[model samples]
Target: MGTITALGLLLLICMVVVGGTQGLQAWISLIFNFAALFFAMVLMAFHLSPVLVTLVTGVIVLAMTIFLGGNDSNSTMVAFYASVAVLILLVILIIPIEHWAQIQGFGQEDSEDLEGMSTILGISYLNVAVSTAILSTLGAIAEAAIAIAAGLAEILEQHPKITLKNLQGAGFKVGSQIIGTTFNTLFFGFFGGFLALFIWFAGVHYSLGEILNDKILVGEVLMVLFSMMSVIATIPLTTWAMVASERQARKKFVK
Candidate 1:
């Protein structure tokens, strides 16, 4: 209740600061994003299907993109769709790599934590582990999509008459820098959050291969790397989509 009240006050502040009726978009974005997030949490809490949960979350994101921006819906929708496509591709790419590296489930130490619980409850630790691996990447994916969309919009605004070739070139250049920083952020963020786990592995004298190839560790690594890849891939994919759409619009005008 307190958190909700805080968010409401924050929304009020944002509305006042932005002035005019601009607060409507913020409210829409907040409502849809929170709805999606809450849906995911409820699904997890209920031990419902992770796949279904992810799907519902995705639908909310799509709805948010489509409805929030009004006049800017086209660009927002394009970016959101492209981001999702890239995420799907990254997941497909990571599966083989994860298997090749033999990373599955959390480390053996966590197994003890599980053993203490009644095994007859039928909760699949492996499912939970894999779900954690996948869900962890969602934050990166969400951020990347927003970044790409915003970047593209800024580029278009700054150079209203920009040619496709120049647009693509600039996107590549900016995207390279963004991707580098994003990957760095992911690496350090993961390391920072899981530092204790790393210490536990080292103090317990786990071998290099054992530690590196541990399921949980590998899952986290894959989550970060693949999310990074998704972002990088979407930059180009989105740029192309924007370019193609503009060209089609011009052609229609000429006709």
Candidate 2:
């Protein structure tokens, strides 16, 4: 087997062993998510509006990741709703940011790779950049939403009569706990993925301004920043969603 295949099998084995049935479902959801992303790319290649495709694909990915992977309906719904909210908000922000940054298309580093290839694909690179930024934030938003929602769901189960104010407090507390780790995960993942690029920058002795303005570097940085913002937004959004749900449920009970 190829290295990737082998590693994938190992991961599957570990998940199955550790997580049991839930792990298997999570793994299946991952496969579905991969298919969704592939289909999205195919649609984009066919010249569909990338932003629309991304928005649709993102919802699909989040559905599979949350609903299929988790057994709890309440938490999954909250996460899905909050994630979509964050996704929509980020899309609004990314389009203008991508346009303003003008970091779309290949950078100088990609020049060698595209020497003879046509850079004209007929699609706006800005849209693609916006899509990239939007897609990058989805995972973080979903994760944070899930974490807070699930934590609040558990609190509801335990306390059963926890006040809305206390529930909101719990949500904020859960969000604060995860924020640091999530930030670190994004930071380290970015740093590790771009370590070679950083070394190249250092070796070439790029000035501070040049490095700051580098298309590749700036694009990655902006994506990370967007993701952080989404995670931050997801916390309160998910909290409010859960609180609203509780309030609605209480009203039904009173009736």
Candidate 3:
């Protein structure tokens, strides 16, 4: 088997051993998630509208993530709605921030890298940048929403009589933990992904200020911050959605 296929099979085996059916479902969802990303890229390459591609991919990925990741129908519904709500809010903020970041095109220092590329690709690089930011942030937002929704669902299952106030408190506690870990994941993930680039910069004797001011670096930092903010915002929104959903269900039952 090819290396990637071998590694994938190994992951499947490990997940099955560790989490059984849930792990298998999670693996399937992961595959679908990757497929969604690939499809988005393919569509965008064909000169399709970036915003439309983003929307389509976001919905598909969210469905696969929530529905195929071992959540029951109710939990899936909650996650889907909460994620969508957070996505809308994030998009509104991302547009203006991307415009302000001013990191659209290749930098003069990057001329060597673009030596063979045509000057006119007939597409707005700014739109692509914004689309990329939106897509990246969407994944984090979905993940946070799904995690919060699933945790809150489990809490309700375990404590059927838990008061709304107590449930909200539980959500806050869980959210705090999620935010802490998620921030670390994003921060270190960026570092790890760019370790080679950092080494190259050091080798070239680029000063810290120059590195920080570089367009690509600034753009990446902005993307990371945008994702972190989305995750942070998702926590409260997901919590509120869960609490409000439960309250509505309780009222309906009473009636």
Candidate 4:
């Protein structure tokens, strides 16, 4: 009926036509992921620790997204594990960086929108920023992890007798292929989403230094950077995880 509804229906149709059962599962997982994020926000609004909520929600979202992706259990499991590890590492990196950056709360661009509105919401904006950063990186982290893990798993499936060394090399190759695309995806997404802000800066004739110093721009830049770091971290981690899983499986079979 509505434009968004029409677009959503079209997407669903296309996915189902192209992917069949896996597409349906992916659609369902998308809904579940939305619900999970909504629930996390509600919890955060209720004064629950944002960090804790984010950590727990991260695990749940990763499990749902990776496991429901229709990959075999081994691949999904390794992906999930590597993703969680990346999430934790990202959280650690995000907290201190967010604090040091002091980019929390509404920026000047949001002032008109926040006019006559109280900014005091009782919760720490630092935590909120940290949560936001963590959440933003999750997609990239999960994607990289699953891609590398799934690719490695498929290679192993085809070459059942593949050496751990060869499998690791294959994993690295897969990771290399995806890394550039993932970085560009994140960069363009950030730029496209904030093209208006960039135009605003240009219209105001802001210098490069001033533009870089803007709270809003810096915040977004940090998110993109965090995502890139997570992807970089996830590649090696997922590769290790897949190789470790294979090693374990082989040991059990031999025993």
Q: TM-score of every model?
A: 0.75, 0.97, 0.92, 0.97
Q: Against the correct fold, how does model 3 do in TM-score?
A: 0.92
| TM-score between candidate 2 and the true structure | 0.97
lDDT of 3 at 102: 80
The C-alpha stretches of model 1 lying farther than 4 A from their native spots are 1-38, 41-49, 62-71, 95-104, 120-130
Shift of residue 255 alpha carbon in model 4, Å: 1.3
Estimate, for each residue in 31-67, the C-alpha lDDT of model 3 and write its tens digit.
Answer: 8888888888888889998877887788778777777
Please rank every candidate by TM-score, starting with the best: 2, 4, 3, 1
Q: What is the per-residue lDDT of model 1 for residues 1-255, given as tens digits with 9 covering 90 to 100?
A: 699889887887888578545576767676767677777766766888654565557545645644454346667766667666765665567556655665554467688787767555444444444455555665566566666666766888888788879877876776776787888888898889988888889898989988776777777777777767766777788777767776787788889
Question: What's the lDDT for residue 218 in model 2?
Answer: 96
Candidate 4 per-residue C-alpha lDDT over 31-83 given as tens digits, one digit per residue, 9 for 90 to 100: 88888999999999999999999999999999888988846888889999999
Model 3, stretches more than 4 Å misplaced?
A: none
Candidate number with greatest lDDT: 4
lDDT of 3: 0.84
Considering summed lDDT, which 10 consecutive residues are worst modelled in model 3?
67-76
Q: Model 2's lDDT to the true fold? A: 0.88
lDDT of each: 0.68, 0.88, 0.84, 0.90
